[model samples]
Target: MQPLETRKDYTYGTLEQNQLLENPLEQLSVWLEQASQAGILEPNGMTVCTVRQGRPSSRVVLLRGMDTGLVFYTNYLSRKGTDTATNAFASASFWWAALERQVRVEGQLEKVSSTESDAYFASRPYESQLASAASPQSQAIERPALEQLVMDLRTNYPERVPRPEHWGGYRLVPDYLEFWQGRKARLHDRIVYKFKGGKWKKERLAP
Candidate 1:
C-alpha cells in the first residue's frame, strides 16, 4: 500500500465582514461573478446534497438560476427529487479551488413556478432539451435502449423539445450561508450568515 502525498498553500485573498453585503444573496452574486471573471471553469457548478431515509446523497449540478435564491432543474422523479420531496430541504456548496474559495448554502426547497421552468427550459440548447425529455432520469434502463431512446427523441423533436412535466426547477431559499477563504499557514476564514428573528445575523467561525 502507498499513501499519496500532496499539498499547497492558499494565499489568493482574504474575506472580511466589511467586504460582505448585508444580504447573503448579494454576497453570493459577488463571489460568483468574481469566479467567472477569474476564469474558473463552470463557475456556476455546485454540489447539491439531499437526505433520504436518514442518509445523505450529493451530486454536482450546474446552477441555472439565482436571484433571491438559487435554482436548479432536474427530473422530479429522480432520486434527488424523491429525497427532496421527503425532506423539503437541501444543502449546496460551490468550491472554486483555483480561487481558494468555497461557498455553502443550506435551505428549504421550493418548486419554481411552471412559467419560470418553461422559460429556462426554452433557453437551453436543443440537444439538452431533447436529452432531458428523453431520459427517465434515475430509472434503470439498458444501455442500447437508453441510446435508442435519445436517438428517437432527436428524430422526433428535430425542431424543438417540450419541457417534460417531471423536468422543472427547484429553488433553495437559504437560511444559512457560509463563505470560506483559504489562507496561508493552514489558517482559514469562515464567515457565516444565519437567518434568525426574521433577519440575517452574521458571525465568524473557527476553521
Candidate 2:
C-alpha cells in the first residue's frame, strides 16, 4: 500500500437543519433540479437495486416521473421485473457529483396502472415505441437478427406504433430517504428521513 498524502486546505459546506427541506421528496426534487442546472449527463439516471429470490441485483435506469413516489419504465418481463416480483422491496440512488449531492431511497415497488403506462407510452417517440414493441428486453438474441427485426418493424409500422403489453412502468413508495452533500475536510452534511408511525421522522447523521 502507498502512504496516504496529507496537508491540504479546505472549507466546510455545512448544511443547517433549517436549510433542509422538511419533506424528503421535496429535497430530492431540489437536488435533481440543481443537477440539471449543472449540466450533469443523464441527471435523471438512477441505480435501482432489487433482490431476486434471495440474491441481490441492480441496474441503472432513467427516472420517468416522481410526485408522491418515484416512477420508472421497463419491460414487465425483464430481469428487473422478475426480481421485483420475487422481492418488491428496492433501493435507488442518485449521484450528481457536479452538484456535490446524492440522494438514496429505499422503498416498496408497485406496478403503475395500465392507463398511466398507456399515456406515457403514447408520448414516446415513434421509433422508441416501435423498438419497445419489437424487442424482448433482457433476453439474449443475435445482434443481426435483432437489427433485422427492428427494420422489419419499421417497415410494418410506418406511422403509429402501439404500446407492448410487456412494457410498462413501476412506482416506488419510499420508506426511507437520505440526502448527502459534500463538504470540506470530509465533514459532509447528511440528513435522513424515515417513514414511521404513519408519518416522516427526520434526523441528522455524522459524516
Candidate 3:
C-alpha cells in the first residue's frame, strides 16, 4: 500500500485576501460559476453536515436556490430534517477538487416560505416529483415496494403531482463561510467571513 504522505502534492495559485468579495455569498457565486464553466459535474451540489444527538452526519444535496442564504430541499421528516428540528445550525461544504477549491458554509437552516418551496417543487421533473412523493426519505423499505409505490402514484396522478407537504425546501442562513484555495505543499489559502453587527466581517485563517 502507498504511504499517505507519498501522494502527489497539490500545486495551485494563491487566493489572496484582497481578491475576495466583501460578501462571502458573492464569492461563492463566482466560484460556483467558475466551477460550472470548468465542466465540474453537479457544481451546485454540497455536503450538508447536520448534528443529531451530538453526533455529526452528512449527505450530499443539490443547491436549489440562493439569495439571503443557500437553499436546498428535502423531506422534512428525513434524518437531516429531524436534526434541524432539534438543532437548526449546520454546515455545508463544497469541494471542486478539479479547481482545487473548497467552500465551507456554517449557518442556521430554516424552512423557506411554503410559497417558495411550492414554486420550486412545481418545477421539478415529473419522475422526481413522483419519487419524492412516494418514497419515505431516510427510511428503510423493500426496493420493490418503493418502486411499486412510485408506479402506483404515477398511475394515480397522470397530470402534475402536487408537492407533498413533507417534501419542501430549507434555506441555510449562513453566519460563517470559509473559502479555501489549495496551493503548493499543502499551504492553502483560507478566507473566512463571519456575519456580525448586521454586516460581514472578513478575516484570514491559517491553512
Q: What is the lDDT of residue 117 in candidate 2?
A: 96
Top model number, TM-score: 3
TM-score of each: 0.95, 0.91, 0.96
Task: Give the residue spans of candidate 3 off by over 4 A.
Answer: 1-6
Clashing pairs in 3: none
lDDT of 3 by residue, 58-148 (tens): 9999998789999999999999999999999999999998888999999999999999989998998998899999999999999999999
lDDT agreement with native, every candidate: 0.92, 0.87, 0.92
Q: Assess candidate 1 and give its TM-score to the true structure.
A: 0.95
Better of 2 and 3 by TM-score: 3
